[model samples]
Each structure stands twice: as C-alpha cells, then as structure tokens.
Target: MHVTFPGRHGADPARAVDGVDLDIRPGEIVALVGESGCGKTTLARSLLGLVPPTAGRVTFGGKPLGYSSRALKAYRKRVQLVLQDPSGSLNPRHTVYDAVAEGLRIHGYGGDEQEAVAQALSRAGLRPPERFFLRYPHELSGGQRQRVVIAGALVLEPELIVADEPVASLDASVRGEILALLLRLRAELGLSALVVTHDLGLAWNIADRVAVMYLGRIVETGEVERVLTAPQHPYTRALLSVLPEAPGDPVVLTGEPPDPSRIPSGCRFHARCQILASGEAERAGVADACRGEDLPLLDGGGRAQVACHWARAVRT
Candidate 1:
C-alpha cells in the first residue's frame, strides 16, 4: 500500500507508506517497528481505512476494502483502533461505562449494552467492571485508563485491533500489565492485532512476528526470536544493538531518517547502513550494488526476509 500527501509548501508529494505489504492472522500479533516518521502510523491507518492508499489496496478476510461510509462503518465493527495516549483517547467527562458503550451506540447494537460493556471491561483486565462504571478518566490510574481504551475496542468484539503504541505513555511497570492483557485477550478471544511501535523490546516480548520498517517500507521480517535475536538487516541490527541486553557497541545512526518526500535511491537505508559503511558489503562484492540497486520488496508473507543487497548477496 502507498499513502502520500502533497508536499509541504509546494515540494514533492511525501510518501508516507510506500509499497509496503503486511498481514495479521487471527490470534496473532505483528509488531511494526521503526524510528519516528518511518510511516508506521500511516500503514496502520491505511489498514484501518482512515487513510486510503494512493496505490495498492488493503484487504480483510481476503476481500478488498471498500471506502463507502456504510462499508467502512461495518468494517470498523470488526476492526478497532487502540490509540497511543490514554489521556487523549478518552473524554474528560465521559464515565467509563459511557466510554466503552460509545461504539455499541454508534453501531446501533441490539444486544444488552450494559452486559456487553461489563464483559469487555472484564476481558480487558478491569475485573469487577461495575465498580469502574461511574468513574471518570481523571479518576483512574494510567494503566486503568489504558485498560478502558482496550475495553472500548473490546466492546466491539473486533476480529482485529490495530494498536498504535499501546503502552508508550504508561509507566514502565504498567506497560507489562497492558501487554499481558493483550496477550491474554488473544488467547481467550482468538483476536489478532497489528501493533505499531518503535520499541523493539516491547515487540520482542509480545509479537509473534516482527516487521522492521525503514523510511516507508519493510526492510526485514521474521518470527520475533529470529528477527530480534538474529537480525539480518542492518537497520534491524542497529536498532537491537542499542538495547541494554544487546551485545557489542551501539550503532549510532548519524542523522534522522531521510525525508519521505525525497527518499534516497537504491536501498532507502543505504546512506545510513552500517554494513556498507563498515566495508562488509565491499568484502562481499556488493558495495556498488548497494549504492545503485534497489532490493526487491518483501512479499509480506510469513517467512524470514531481508531487503538488503549485502544481506542477500551474503545469503546466496
């Protein structure tokens, strides 16, 4: 999928999501990781139908997404969004009960509204759901507010939840609780999720699979263990190398990611690629290709793949 916007102040159009492909299966969690401005949120928005891709299409249940208001409303019932900030996601005045029931009311649910709200709250790890119904957002703890957000999504009983930085705003201790809640929800509800985050540690802990994004495209992907522990792409390795538990010296990328409006040629990551800079590609006889050959995009399937001329040449 490709999502672009007219460039700022009459510059070229900025490509927020460019030729990216990803999939989320039932009960599975796929983490999309990258630095800020790497287009993770845009990709998630495209899947949520808030931003239509300028090229390609988003599909759910093997069918193409429709942009009609009715179809989108129906799709939203099956796929919900859990935003990054609990403080911003909830209204200051809406009680917990009202907040969770908002989706039900909008969708014109015919079932017992109160019962559904209670079940969703309990499922989201807010046990004894009735006790929190009368409470306001300011009255709850950060973790609790996040739970309420999850409960909002849960109330819809969605097949998939596209969470954008689910725990980034919570306390360190609270992050684990929220993550555990998501894992438990998947186990008990068979729910799938596309978690957009920059924290590789969070992805390593919760995701079944990981896709590393660079600029606007996936540079590497595999099972969490393989991708996090044995990253093949220089970008993935650079990210992991800075973790507290990671071995070796950190790879400090010199500059911010290239502006999407002016993505570099060949490998989008080549300019900052440590492998090429360290002469590894030269030894492998692909240094010239690294500067001139654009690696093929990943098929976005369930297999290990790395989009780097150097990595591919070494593997072959």
Candidate 2:
C-alpha cells in the first residue's frame, strides 16, 4: 500500500506519509518501526481506511480501495484494527460479549452469535470464553483487556490486522504474552498483520520483516534479522545502537527530527545524520547526493532496501 497525507494549516504540504511503497504478503507479520509521530500510525490507519491517502493508492488483492460506505464496510470485514490502548478503545459500559459481537452485528453475520463470540474469545486466548462474556472492561486486567480487544478484531475473522502499539500499555511480562499470542494466531490461522510500534525489541521478537520509518518515510526495510543486525540507514543504526544487546558505542542522534510541515530537502534525515555530519559521506563522495538529491529506496539485490545515498555508497 502507498499512502500520503496532506499537511495541516497553511504550512508547506509535506506528506505525513510520503511516497512510500510497502507490501505485506499472506500470513506475514510486518512491523512498522519508528519514533513517535513518525507517521507509522498514519500508514497503518490508511490500511484500515481510517485515513484516506492524499496521494497514492491502497490496493487489496489487486483491487483499489473504495470510499463508499458499503465498500468500506466490506473492506473492514477483511481488515481490522487493534488500537494502542484497549481501555481507550473499548467502551466502559459495554460488556466483553457486546464488544466482540459488535462487528458481527454491523456486518449482519447470520451465523450463531454466541458461538462466534465464544470462538473469537478462545482464539484470542481468553480461554473457555463464557467466563468473561458478562465482564466489563474495568474488571479485566491489562493483558486481559488487550486480549478482549484482539477478540473483538478476531470476531470479524479478518485476513489482516493493523495493530497500533498493541502491547505498549501492558506490563513487560504481559507484553511478551500478547506478542506470543499474536504469533500463535498467525501460525494457526495464517493471519497477516501490520504491527505499528516504536519498540525495535518487539520487531526483533515477532516481525518477519521490519520497515524503519523516519519522518513519514521508510528509511530501511528488510527481513527482521538483516535489518536489525546490519541496519543500513543511519537512523536505523542509531535506533539499534541503543539496544542493550548491541555491541558498540551508542550512536546517539544530535537533534530532533524536523517537523512534517517543514521537512528538509533531499534526504529528510541529513540534518541529524551523524554519517553526513562526520564527513564519512564526503569521504565516500556521496555528500552532494545526500544534501541535494532526493534518494528513493533502492533495492540492494539482496534481502534489504534502504533510502539513503550514504548507506548505499558505504554498505553496498
């Protein structure tokens, strides 16, 4: 899917999601990783048809997404969203059964509602299902609430789930459990998922592939092992450098990312890129390209793709 959003106010219309091209194959788990406000959520929301793209198109099974209510409703049945916060997502007054069954009701599923709800709850790891049907959101633990949220998505039996920070609100142990559950669901049901998260650890834990977003653009992408172990983009390297398991001096960035409305020319990351600032790019003879020419994501003819001229010149 390719997605872009218009800039707000009268500022320059820098795309919240620039000209990005990404794909999630069947049964694949692709993590969209970045710092906060890097437009990972916007890209994820576009997949769910929540935020329509100002430019570019999102296609499902080769068909372009439509804006009609009926078209959107049908599309939603196939693609579901699991929000960052279960507490904020779930209605306090609604019971577990109501929350899970709402999608079925909206889609007018004629199947047995009780059985459908039970199966969804079971699939989400809320074992036995019946025990939690009458319970409210406030009564459930953080993990359980997240499970309930997943169950709600499961009720639609979607082929793809766009999870925005699915485990960010849970305890450390619970985060693992929830991630494990997502993995199990993919294994059992062949479900494809687009997980939006800032945690590289989470990407390393569950994603089959990782796309590192920087200021609304994917700077680096590849198989999880390749991208995390040998990141090409300086932004990606800086991110991995901070991990406890990484062996080396940390590559701390010097400045904040530029505002979306006021994005820099050429490489969006050049302003804070240590490689360019340290003269490595100049020594490599790619400084002019890094500072003047827009670098599109270039496939390395291997497992990884990167969008920086310096990364291409130095690593390839």
Best by lDDT: 1
How well is each residue in 76-122 modelled by candidate 2, as lDDT tens digits? Answer: 99999999999999999999999999999999999999999999999
Query: lDDT of candidate 2 vs native?
Result: 0.90
Best by TM-score: 1
Clashing pairs in 2: none
Q: Residue-wise lDDT of candidate 1 within 47-161, one digit each (tens)?
A: 9999999999999999999999999999999999999999999999899999999999999999999999999999988889999999999999999999999999999999999
lDDT of 1 at 233: 90
Off by over 4 Å in 1: none
lDDT of each: 0.94, 0.90
Give the C-alpha miss distance for residue 305 in model 1, angstroms. 0.2
Tell me the TM-score of model 1. 0.99
Q: Supply the TM-score for candidate 2.
A: 0.96
TM-score of every candidate relative to the true structure: 0.99, 0.96
Worst 10 residues of 1 by lDDT: 293-302
